[model samples]
Each structure stands twice: as structure tokens, then as C-alpha cells.
Target: MDFLLEIIMTPAILACLKIAVIILLFAMPLGTLLTLMERKWSAMIQDRVGPNRANIGKFTGNGLLHIAADGLKSIFKEDTIPKGANGFLYLIAPFFGLIAAVAIFAIIPIAGPIGNFTFQVTDVNPGLLFIFAITSLNVYGAVLAGTSSNSKFALLGGTRASAQMISYEVFMGLALMGIFMVYGTTRVSGIVNGQNEYWFGNLVPMWGIFTQPLGFILFFTALVAETKRAPFDAPEGESEIVAGYFLEYSGMRWSAFMLAEYVSLVGVAALMTTLFFGGYHVPWLHLWENAPQWIVTILQILKFTFFTVVFCWFQIQLRWTVPKFRFDQTMGLGWKKLLPLSLVNIIVTALVILTLA
Candidate 1:
């Protein structure tokens, strides 16, 4: 019993557990709020009331409480397992979806520092590869869910999803090559630290977005495809495919897929912030450098959270603004356009950096 307890208490095991719960708890709600924001923003864009109806009885309109209402609605709904579906695989699908979504946050830097420890879950040497590896697992969930459903629409959705993910993953990783080249390290925390020094002593706050705008564009486009989101969301084409891979899932099972989608959105946005936007660095923040460490830490956390919320809002707005693409068009954009462009950008950026050096 003592040996077993020792194994359980190992640093690796405890770290894994902490990271797992942190990713799930934080990522899940961020996604849910993104869903609500999508509705609210879409309403604003179209000059219509979005979801004010989802409220507590007396108030009739509570902005944040709508999320609570949505959760309860999903929980109380009747869970239905289809007659022809593979019961075991059907149950497994949503869990895989959720797990894939939650796993990607392991390497993201959320705050500057918490005491002597970094707020990053893991300061991995191969951090960038870890992110791509975990995100690549998303395809399995979509494919398995679709194939197990035993429905024609589900199969089509799954196939489209798999193809789209594979095509985009190539360029998604390629987009970061410029970042790795410029920073000379694959460690995310190192990249953040590298940006701390100014270019001309005016607090330039050198971010990846400014140095490699094309890479940023490529990353953003590829991420949109990866998340199965608008302008690239051909796999789950609601109008044409009728809800894609999750056509047959109902109740809590279906809710899991929905949750996974939103979580993925948040994860991608957080990544974009960390990789291209200097993580939690606020412009002109050096003046407060000599301030109390605790105060500085709180300011950094606030900055990170603020940008997180802003990006979340941006994604919601983009969803409402953009329309889904044709399947062929989506694939063409990834393979024919984004991929080649990203490769060229990597080469150009490296050459420019070397010449400047």
C-alpha cells in the first residue's frame, strides 16, 4: 500500500492530474461563454435581440446567468442512444472530443509568474510539438463519432473533418517555424521572455505578430480550420450537411461535443495570444516594473485575462460575421493557398532576421 501510494504521489502523476483538471475547469467555461457571445454579437450585427429570453424568473434578463441556464437545460434533457449505433463507441466519442480539447492547454503560458513558479502548466522543451500533437487528436473524436453513428450525414461529416484537419495541421505547424527561428527556442516561456527586451529602448515589446504577420495570418486561418469554425467549417456544415458529425447525438452526449468545440475555440485563442501577442505583456508597462512583486503579478494576470476575453469576443464576432465555406473551397484554401504561403513566409522571415542580425 505504501509503494502504491508513493507511485500515486510521484511528481509526474500529480502534475498530470493538476494540469488535467486546470485545463478542463478553465477551458470549458471559456468555451461556454464564447457560445453565448456568438449569439449576442450575431444579434447586434443583425439588429435583433439575441438571447435575452434565457433568464431567471424575476429578472427576466441576466446576462451571465444565461450560461447557467444553458447548462441546466443540457443536464435535464433526455439522453438518447440510437438503436443502430455502437453503444460503447457512441459513449466514447464525446469523451474523446472533450479530452482532445482539454489536452492542448498543457503547454500554454497563462501568466508571467506566480511567486517563483511560472503560471504555465509545463515549460516543456518540445512545447510547440506538444501543442500540435494534442490538437491533432481532435480528428479522431470527429471521425469516431461520425463512423459510430452509422448515419450517412455523420460519415460524410467525419470524412470532411478528417481531410480538413490533416490539410490544415501541416501549415499550422509550419506557421510556427518562423517563431521558432526568430526566438531560437521551441520553449513557449523562453519565447515570452525573449520579447521582454525592447528593440530601440522605447518599450517596443517585440511581438511575433509584428515580425511575422503572414505567419500570424497562416496560423489564424489554419486554426479556424482546426476548430471547424466559420469560413472553414465545411465538415459540420449545418445548412448542407445538417449538423455534420454530431447529427445523431442527443442530450448530455451531444452537449459534450458542443462543449468540446467551444473549448477548442478558447484554447486556440489563448495560444494565439501567447504565441503572437506577447502572452500577458501590456504596452508601456515597464514604468511599473519596480512596483511590488505581488501587485505586478496581479497586473499581469489581469492583462492576460483581459486579452483572453477580448480574443474570445473577437472569435464570437467572427463566427457571426463569416459564413461557412464550400468543402472544396475550404480544402483549397488550406492546401493551395495557406500552406504554400506559410512556407514562403518562413523562408522570407528567416532570411530577413539573418540579414538584420
Candidate 2:
């Protein structure tokens, strides 16, 4: 019993618990909150009031109550399985998406190390590759949902989704090759540390954005497409496909899909923070190296959270601002345009590195 207690008190176990709590309390809730914010944001863009009707007594919480209301509604709502649907796959599909979305956080360092505990769940050496591997499984969720539904529209959406995700994924990987070449390591912590320096004798940050501007653009565009936002959301073209791969899902299952989307949105934002925006490193934070460790930790956490929220807002704005693309247009842009550009970016990055070396 003492040994077991000691094991439970170990740093590894504590880190795991911290990670789980952060994901559940912070990441998941933030994602759901974004759903409300998205509505309000779009309404503001369109010059309309949003979501103020959800209230308790006189306190509406300015539509903040909608998040809880939505959750309770989903819980009580009837879950319907299609008449001819594959019951097993239908039930498990949402979990695939939710898991994939949440798993990416494991490699993201939230606020550097605090004593024996790091903010990240795991410090995998091949951090970027691990992200790609896990995110690749997300396609399975859409495919399974579509195929199991036994609906033509669902299948079409699934097919388009898989193709789109695969296409953009290639560009996304290639675009980041420039960063890997510049940083010389695939570990996210290594990359973040690399960005902590200043360039031009303290005049400018040596951030990934400075070193890989073109790569940032390319990677961000590919990421937005990967998340299936507007202008690239042909897979779920609601105008044509009704509700796409999730047409048959209802209640909590449907909620799970929505949650996965928002959660994935947050995950992408965090990745963007880690890869290009300097992770938790604030500008000139090195000047405060002698500050208390707790103060530094809090500052880093706030910085990371701010950047993540900004990126999430940017994504929401992009969704409402752009019109959906046609299927052919989407395919052409991914394959003919982004893919070629990513390759060129990599080539240029390599040559520059060789010249400097």
C-alpha cells in the first residue's frame, strides 16, 4: 500500500492528472464556449443580435447561459440511430474525432517547466510527426460516420472529406518542413526554445514567424482547410449535402461531432502557437530571467492562452468571412496550388540554410 501511494505521488502520475484536468476543465470548456462566441461573433458581423434569449430569471449572462443550456438539451434529447446504420460504428465514430482532437494537446508545452512538472503531457522527440500521425486518424471518423449511415449524401460528404483532409495534409506537412530545416529539431520544446532568442542584436525576435513567414502562411492556410472551415468546407457543403456525414446523428452523438470540431479548432490554435508564435515565450521575456519562477510561469501561461484565443477568434472570423468553395475548386487549390507552393517553400528554405551554413 505504501508503494502504491508512492507511485501515485510520483511526478509522472501528477503530470498525467494535471494534463487530464487541464483538458477537461480548460480545453473542452473553452471549445464549447467558442460555440457561443462564434454565434455572437457572426451576429456582430452580420449586424444581428445573438443568443441572448437563453437565460435564468433576469440574468441572461449575456448569452453565456447558452452553453450550459445546449449541453443539457443534448443530454436529454433522443439519440436516434438510422434504420439501416451500422450500430457499432455509428456509436463509436464521434469518439474517434473527439479523441483525435484532444490527443494533440499531449505534446504542447503550455508554460515551460515548473519544478519537476512540465505543462505538457508528454515530451515526445518526434513531436510534429506524432501530431500528424494522430490527426491523420481524424479522417476515419468522417468516413465511418458516412459509410455506416448508409446514406448517399453522407457517403459523398465522407469521400470528399477524406480526400480534402488528405490533400491539405500533404501541404501542411511540407509547409512545416521549412521550420524543421530552420530549427534543426522536431521536438516542440526545442522549437520553442529556439524562438526565445533575439535577432539583429536585440532588435527583433528570432521567432518562427520571422524565420519562416511564407511557411507560416502556407501552414496556416492548410490548417484552416484541415479544420474544414469556410472557403474549403466543400466536404460539408451544407447548401448541397444538407448536413453531410453527420446527417443521421442526433442528440449526444451530434453534440460529440460539434464538440470535436471546436476542440480541434483549439488544438490547431495551440499548434500554431507552438510552431510559429513562440509558444509561451513573451517578447523580451529573457529580461526577466531573475524574476520569481512562479511569476514567470503565470506570465507564460497567460501569454500562451492569449495567443491561443486570438488564433481561435481568427478561425471563427475566417469561417464567416469566406464563402464555401466548389468541390473542383477545393481539389484544384489543394493539389495544384498549395501542394506545389509547399514544395517550393521547402526547396527555398533548404537552399537558404545551405548558403548560411
Candidate 3:
């Protein structure tokens, strides 16, 4: 019994619990809130009222109640499987997307060390590679959903999704090669720590953005495409393919797809934070090296949260402001434009690093 208790109380077990709680309580709710925000933001852009109907005794909470109403509606709605659909894959595909999106957060550090614990799920060494591998699995969710639905539109959406994701992923990986080469390590936390350094008598940040400006642009663009958002959203082009790969889905299963999209939005923001914007490092934060650890930790968390929220808003803004690219235009940009530019960025970064060394 003592041995059992000890095992249950181990640090690894506690960390696992912490991670699970963070995902459920923090990440999940944030994704849901983002869905609401997307509606509100788009409404603001298009001059329309957004989600003001759901209420209790004239207390709608300024559209916030819609989130709860949406959740309840999905839960109570009919979950339909098409007569010709492969029921097994249709049921499981949403889980694949959600899991793939949420898993990326495991390796992402939210803040620096606090006592004997760190604010992350696990500190994997090949952190960037791990991210790429897990995110690539998300394509399978789209592919499976399309194939299993047994509809031409769904299949076309899935095929486009797979092709588009595969194309951008090549550049996404190459876009970060400059970061890995400059930082000299693939560990996420290590990259964050490296960004804490100062340059020119503590005037400028040694952040990824400073060293790899072009790379940041490429990575951010590729990331937006990877998340299947506006401008790069040809795969799910409503005008062309109806609702795309998720056309047959309804109820909670459909909600699962939306949740996955928003979660991937958050994950991409976090990755951008960790890679380019200095993670949890406050600008010139090292000046207060002797500050209390807990205070510093809280400040770091706040900074990271602020940046993530801003990026989320930015993505939502893009969705409303920009027009979706034509499928051919999307393919051409990814393959002919972004791909070549990323390759050039890598070579240029290498030469700069070698010369400076």
C-alpha cells in the first residue's frame, strides 16, 4: 500500500495530472471562447450583430451566453450517420483531430521553472520535430472523414486538405531550420531561454524574430495555412465544396471539428510565441534577475498569455478581412512562392551564421 501511494504521488504522475487539468480547464474553454470571438470579430468587420439571442430572463451576458447555449445544443442534437457512410471512421475522425491539436501543447513551456516544477507537460529534446510529426497526423483526420463520408464533395475537400497541408509542411519545416541553426538546439525550453539574452549593450532582444525575420514570416504564413484558415482555406471553400471534409458531420462531432480548429489556432500561436516572440520572456526581463521567482513566473505567464491572445485575434481578423485564395492560387503560392523563399532563407541564414561565427 505504501509503495502504491508513493507511485501515485510521484512527480511524473503529478505533472500528468497538471497537464490534463490544464488542457480541460484552460485550453478547451479557450478554444470555445475563441469560437465566440470569431463570430463577434467577424460581425464587427461585416457590420452585423453576433450571437445575441440566447438568454435567461433578459440577461444574455452580451453574447457570452451563446457559448453555453451552443454547447447544450450540440449535446442535445441528433448525431446522424449517413446511410452510405463508414460509421466507424466517421465516429473516430473528430477525436483524431482534437487529439492531434491538443498533443502539440504538451511540449510547449508556458513559463520558466517554479521551484522543483516547470510549467509544461514534458520537455522533449527534439521539440520542433515532435511538433511537426504530431501536427502532420491531423491531416489523417480530414482524410479519414472525407473518405468515410462517401461523398464526392467530402472526398475532394479531404484530398485538397491533404495536398495543401503536405505542401505547406515542407516549407514550415524548412522555415524553422534557420531557428534551429541559430539557436543550436532543438529543445523548446532551450530556445526560449536563448531568447532571454541581450545584444548591443542590452538594447535589442536576441529573439528569433530579430535573427530570422524572413523565417518568421514564412513560418507564420505556413502555420496559418496549416490551420486551414482564411486565404489559405481552399480545402474547405464553402463556395466550391460546401462544408468540405466535415460536410456530413453534425452535433457534437461537428463541434469536435470546430474545437480542433480553434485549438490548433491556439497551438500555432503558442508555437509562434515560443519560436519567434521570446516565449514567456518579458522584454528586457533579465534586468531583474534577482526578482522573486514566483513573481517572475507570474509575469512570464501573463506575457505569454497576452501574446497568444493577440495572435488569436490576428488570425480571426484575417479571416474576416482577407478573401479566400483560389485553389490553384493557393497551390501556386505554397509550391512556387513560399517553398523557394524558405529555401533561400535557409541558405542565407546559414551563411550569416557561419560568417558571424
Candidate 4:
């Protein structure tokens, strides 16, 4: 019993718990609220009321309570598994979905140094590889959920998902190669540190977005595809595929898949924040060289917060602005367009770096 306690309560375990809680607390509510916000934003864009009907007993029209109501409503709804579905796989699909979504958080650099310590989890040297590896896991969840359902629509969705993920991942990794070459490091924290160097004069800190604009654009596009959202969301097309992979799931299981999608949204936002937007580094961070630890911590948090909000807003805007692409168009854009461009971008970046040196 004592041994079990010691193992379970280790510093690593505690750290994992804190990270999980931080991610979950931010992710779950943010996702649910964003669902409402999307609707509200869409309504304002088109001129209509959205989700104002949800309320507590007395507190009517309070947008805050709608999140709780919608969640509870989803919780108590019917739990149904299709008659022909593989019961065990069907049961596990949502778990896989949520797991893939949440796992990416492990590699994201949330903030700058807190005194001598960094405001992240393990800052593994192979952080770029880690992102690629975990992102590959996401397709499995989609494929399994679709295949195990024994439904035609689900199968089509799964096929699209698998192909789409594979096609886009190529460019996603290649796009990062530019940044990797620029920094000569795979660690995300290290990449941010590389950006700490000043360019030109005292102004213009060297961010990857400025140095590798083409790579950043390709990375951002591929990330959009990888998240299986927006213009790339043909798999979940209600007009044609009928809710895609989750067609066989209902109740909490369905909710898990929904939650996973939003978590993935947040994960992509965080990744974009870390890779391109400078993680938690405020402009002229080096200028605060002598600031106290608490002050530095606050600054880091504020930076992260600003970027987080911006990323969320950008995602919401994307959802509204971009129309869904046809399946073939998606494949073409990924392979014929982005993939080759990313490779060329890499070659050009490498040659420039070599020539300049």
C-alpha cells in the first residue's frame, strides 16, 4: 500500500495531474462556450438570435448558464449503440478520440521561464517529432470509429479521414523542417529560444513567422487540415455523410467525440501559438532581464493568454469564413499543391541558410 502510494504520488504524477487539470479546465469549458459563441457570432453575422433560450430556473437569457444546460442535456440523453456495430470498438472509439486530442498538450510550450524553471511540461529535445507522432494517432481514432460501426456512411468517413490525415501530415512535417533548420533544434522551447535573437537593430526580434513566412503559411494550412475542421470537415458532412464516424455512437459517447474535436481545436491553436506566434514570449522579453520572478511569470501568462484568445478567435472566424471543400479538392490541395510547395520551400530555405553563412 505504501509503495503504491509512493508511486502514484510521485512528482511526475503530480505534474501530469496539474497539466491535465489545466488543460481540461481550459479545454472543456472553452470548447462548450465556443460552441455557443460560434452560434452567437454566426447569428450576429447573419442577423438572428442564437441559444438564448438555455437558462436556469430564474436566470433567463444568461449566456453563461447555457453551457451548463447544454452539457447536462447531452449527458442525460439516450445511450445507443448501433445494432450491427462492434460493441467493444464502439465503446472505445470516443476514448481514443479524446486521448488523441489531449495528448498534443504534452509538447506545447505554454510560457517562458519562471525564475530558473520553464512554464511547460517535459521539454523533450525531440519535441517536433513528438507532435508528428501524436498527430498520427488521431487518424486511428477516426478510422477505428468509422470501420467498427459497420455502416456505409461511417466507412466512407473513415476512408476520407485516413487518406486526408496521411496526405496532409506530409506537408505539415515538411513545413516545420524550415523552422527546424533555422533553429537547428527540434525542441519547441529551443525554437522559441532561437527566436530570442534580435535582427537588424534593437527592434524586430526574430520570429519564425517573419523568417519562414512560406513555411508558416504551409504549416498553418496543414494544421487546419490535420484538425479535420472547417473547409476540411467533409468527413463529418451532415449533408452527405450524416455525422461521419460518430454515426454509431450516442449519448456520452457522442459527447466525448465532440469534446475531442474542440480539444483538438485548442491543441492546434496552442501549437500555432508555440511555433509561430512566439509561445509566451512578449516583445522585447530580453529587456525584462532583471525583472522579478513573479513579474516575469505574470508577463508570460499574459502573453499566452493574449495568443490563446487570438487563436481561438481566428479558429472561430475560420469556421464561418471557409466553405467545405469537396473530398477530391481536399486531396488535390494537400498533395498537388501544399505538399510540393512545402518541399520546395524547405529546399529554398536550406539553400538560403547555407549561402548566407
Candidate 5:
């Protein structure tokens, strides 16, 4: 009983609980719903009915049952290993992406500090670098799956993924130079809190979107491509390379890859919210200085959730709306265009900050 109380009452334990709540209860569920959301959204964009077929007897819940149906199918379906595959690497490849996707939320907070506790699992100093490092690990899943599968299509897909990650990752890091300059810290919480300040006599919040618009665009684009979504999806070219590196996977292994994709989709949105939007901050909440802490905390969580959903919706819409770029075009955009612009953005931002200082 005493140990249980320690587990329940310790501040560190509470922080862990918050992290679990955010990732398990929030991020995972949202990712699951987004799978349905993307299909439904694409159908709407294409002027057709969305998924409404998966039903439990009389209740389909407007295609919500598809989530369960998919889960069961992945579980009950036979797991297969291709001939000539590296058995150990092939079995473990799917988890690399999943691990990376879930790890990102550890440093992400859903709200401001509440009394003696914070709404995050860990508060390391070099948080943004941690994010970059974790994100870069996602490529391993593709590379391993492709190499181990022993298929020409998967091999080609893995090659594309490696090149794509290498190109975009450069500009992705370059793009953040401006934000790091503006905030003067690599800590994500610091950056989020820095945005809470208002400028022009409190008329506007100094959001990253306003200060580093180009960086936001570059970062988000790189992140999308990193997830191997459409438009930048040459790595998973279902038509061109037969589901890319994940083509040979079946049963829960295939499901794991898909889950990683959706979770990363959510991660992208969460990163955007943290770095650009006011990150769990309700704008002008300072006006209500007398509000209860519980109320304020609730409001912050709601604000974060709202923006996250909107961004998810936007990404889904973007995938359906934009045409897929050929592999070369995708590479060209990252190296030829975004890289140069990101360099320019960094130089100009530094000069501006120096002059202002």
C-alpha cells in the first residue's frame, strides 16, 4: 500500500502518468482515427462515399468499425517471411519506425506547468536536437526492411528512402537555424514559452509562424517526406515500387509500418504545434489572470488538441489535393530549392537579429 501510494503520489510518477496519457490516450487514438480520417477525407475530395462498410451487426458507427476490423485482420492474418530474407532483421525492421515515432512524445508537453509538476515526461536541455536525432532514426526501418526482404522493388524503395532522408534532413536542420537564432536555445519548451510573449504592445503573439515562416514550411515539408507520405512518397511508391520497403511484410508486421506512419503524421502535427503554434497556450489567456489553475490547464489541453486535429486534417487534405512528385522532382525540390532557400533564411535571420540587438 505504501509503495502504491509512492507510485501514485510521486511527482516523477505523475509526470510519467501524464506522458502515458498524452501518448497512449491522445496520440495513439488520434493516429488510429486519422487512418479513417484520411480515407474519408480522400473520398470526399474525390467526390465519393467514404468507408461505411465495416459494421458490427447493425452499427457501423459511420465506418468507425473499420478500425477494429483492421486491427483484427492484422492480428489473425498469417505472418509471412519471404524466401532468402534475413530472418532476424526482417522480423525487427517494422519496430524501428514505431519506436522512433513514439519516442518523440517524451519531451513534448501538452500544457504549461501546473503547480509543482509539468506536463512532460522529461525536460532535457537539448530537446530540439533530441527530436532531430530521433527523427533521423526512422530511415532505418525502411533501409532494413528493403535490404532484408530480398526483393528488387523493396530494394529500390529502400534506396529512394535513404536518398530522400539524406537530402531533406540537411535542409530540415538548416531550416531550424532561424528558430534557434530567434529563441536562442535548443530547448523545445523554451521555444514554446518564448512564443507566448506578445509583440506590438500585446497585439500579437510572437509565434514561430510569424517570425520563421519559411522555417515552418521547410520543417513541415521535410517532416512529411520523412514520414513517406504522398507527394514525397517515392519510397513507398505503391504503384512504382510495390509498397516500397514494406511490400514483403504481412499480418501485424505490415500493420506496424502503417501505424508508424500515422503516428509520425501525428508527431509532425505535434511538432508544428510545439514549435510554431503557441503549443498548448490559449492566446490572450493572460487576460483572465484570476482563472483557476485547473481551468487554465484544461483550456491549454483543449487548445493543443484542437490545433493538432486541424493540422492532421490539413495533412490528409494535402495528400489528397497534391499530386505525387516523381522521385527526381522530390529530390530536386529538397536539394535545388529548399536547401538554398533555407540557407538564405538563416543568413537573413541572423543579420536581422544582430541589427536588432
Candidate 6:
């Protein structure tokens, strides 16, 4: 046991373990499960049982078998590259989204810090800016996939994705400025710590949602748009653009693009929990400052996971609940409506901060 502890308890090992815990245990598994959950949940919402065909010897496992069935089907399918397509760029494009999506988890805190060890992968000072940079790279996946497909439809989808993602990026950052100001720090860990603070002598927790309600609304709207989910999913509208930027991909390559979207869906949930919610801090848990560290940590993790899953389900529900926006209408909402509102939110936050000070 001491030998195992010596191997597992080092700083380097702990960091690597945190990465595995976040990426493999949490993000990837939840993201993969969501692909099926979306279908199942949507079916339930619309009064139907979703995808139960995959079975073995009279056992269906309900709809859970479909996950493995889908994977096996994708693995056996042919991957076709378009004639005259840029082979290199087409091959690499799918990874950009997946990479960017997976990277977002690096800064998210799953539980409060425990002594020298933290629940997060990295607590960088330029926390949110790093997020912006990573998210911007996701645009390259759509653009490259569309451009290299040698098809007008794919190119159009890519173009739309580029414009929409870029536009929402501005609003997303602007919406977050309020949180940055209210928390008085850009470091995500610091922000989470700040939210543990109560207002008016413990009457209420100072979660970002309570303090910056408008900012929260704008920020979440921007997150939905940024992920190119429903309403804002004009880039991939099946009625017009078919599959959009990834129309030509097949096999696991196609799955990669899809996985990127689902993974990003999970990433968005984590970010929402970290920013708008109180992160891993349980409401009033700090009231017992002398509580055992292990119990506090467990409760914090549970609270964080609960909020993240709720947000994920909420996003999926939102996709099915709202109708898709027209491509032009989508852009207009971002520029004319959300953009201005985000700016106003930031201005109001600054003034409020000054008044309180």
C-alpha cells in the first residue's frame, strides 16, 4: 500500500490522474452517453421509445445496446474522400473540434481544492481567455471540412459555421465580463472560491446566476449558439445544407465530427456549472468550516456533477424544444440582439461593482 501510495501520490502522478479523471472518467463517458441520451430523451418527450433494435438472443438491454451497435456499424462503414478534395486537410479537420472540445475541461474544477492538490487540471491566471482561444479553434474543423469536401453544400455550411461561431465568440466573451468583474478575478478557481462567499451575512450565496442574472442569460444563450445546437444549428440544417460541413465524411471519421459535437455539449455544461453556478461549492456547506475534509470533498463533487448533468439535460431538451432558426435570423440574433445585450450587461456590471465598492 505504501508502494502504491508512493507511486500514485506524487505531484506529477496526481496531475496525470486528474487529467484521466476529468477527461476519461467524466467528460468522454458523459459525452458519449449523451449521444444516445439525446435520442432517448427526445423520444420520451415526443411519446416514442427510441432505438431498441440492437439485441442479443432475445435480450435488448432496453436501448443501451444501441450505443455499441452504433459503434460497430460506424467501424465497419467505408470512409470515402471526395474526388479532388484536399486529402490532408480533410483527414485532419474532424479532430480540431474534438481537440478543442476536450481541452475545455482542463480548467474546470470538479471539487474544491484540498490542501496542495486541486480538483482542476490547471488553474491558469488567464482562465477564460484560454477558453476563448480553444473554442476559436473549433471553427477550423467546420471550415476545413467544408472547404475540402469539393461540394457547394459543404462549403456553404462551413462558411455559415465560421460566421456564426465567430459572431457568438464575441458575445460569449462579453457576457463573461460580468462574471469576471463580479468575481474580481479571471482565474476559475478564484471565481469558484469567491462564489462561496455569502451576501448580507449569509442570507444568500453569491453565485454568478444570482449576481449577474442578465449576464447568465446572455452567456448561456451565447453558449448554445456557440455549440451550434438547435435554433442556432443553421450551419447543419438538414432541410437545406444536408449534413453541412461534414456531409462527405463516413465511418469513424464521421463519428469523430459527431463525437466532437456531443463532447462540446458536455463541455458547455461544465462551463455553465463552473461560471454561472457556484461550481463545486455546496450552498451553505462552508457554514461548517470544521467539517471533515473527505466528506466536504465528496459533497462538493456530487453537487458539481449534479449541476453539470442537469445543464446537459437542459441543453438537450432545449435542442428538441425549439425550432431551428433560419440562417439569416440566426446571425441577426447574434449581432443585433445578443451582442448589444452582452455589452450592456458588462457596462451595468461595472457600474454596479463601483457602487458596491
Models 1 onward score TM values of 0.92, 0.97, 0.96, 0.93, 0.97, 0.97
Query: Which runs in model 2 stand beyond 4 Å of their true positions?
Result: 1-12
Worst 10 residues of 4 by lDDT: 113-122
Tens digit of per-residue lDDT, candidate 1, span 201-253: 76477888887789988998888889898878888888888999999988788
Clashing pairs in 5: none
> Once all C-alphas are superposed, what RMSD does model 6 give against the true structure?
1.3
lDDT of 5 by residue, 105-133 (tens): 98888898976578877778988889889
Candidate 4: tens digits of C-alpha lDDT, residues 171-244: 89999999999989999889988877778875887888888999988998888888788889977877799988
**Worst lDDT window (10 residues) for model 3?**
18-27
List runs of model 4 lying over 4 Å from the truth: 1-10
User: On residues 231-282, what C-alpha lDDT tens digit does candidate 6 reach at each position?
Assistant: 7888898999998999999999999998999999999999999888899999
Q: Give the C-alpha lDDT of model 3.
A: 0.90
Task: Write down the RMSD of all candidates, one decimal each.
Answer: 3.4, 1.8, 1.9, 2.9, 1.4, 1.3
**Candidate numbers, best lDDT first, in rank order:** 6, 5, 3, 2, 1, 4
Q: Which stretches of candidate 3 lie over 4 Å from their true place?
A: 1-9
Runs off by more than 4 Å, candidate 1: 1-21
lDDT of 2 at 231: 80
**Residue range with the least summed lDDT across 10 consecutive positions in model 5:** 114-123
Q: Mind sharing the TM-score for model 4? A: 0.93
Q: What is the Cα-based lDDT of residue 68 in candidate 1? A: 79
lDDT of each: 0.82, 0.89, 0.90, 0.82, 0.91, 0.91
Candidate 5 segments whose C-alpha is farther than 4 A from its true place: 1-5, 9-12
lDDT score of residue 61 within candidate 6: 83
Cα lDDT tens digits, model 2, 262-351, are 999999999999989999988787776588888888999999999999999999999999888899998898899988998999999999
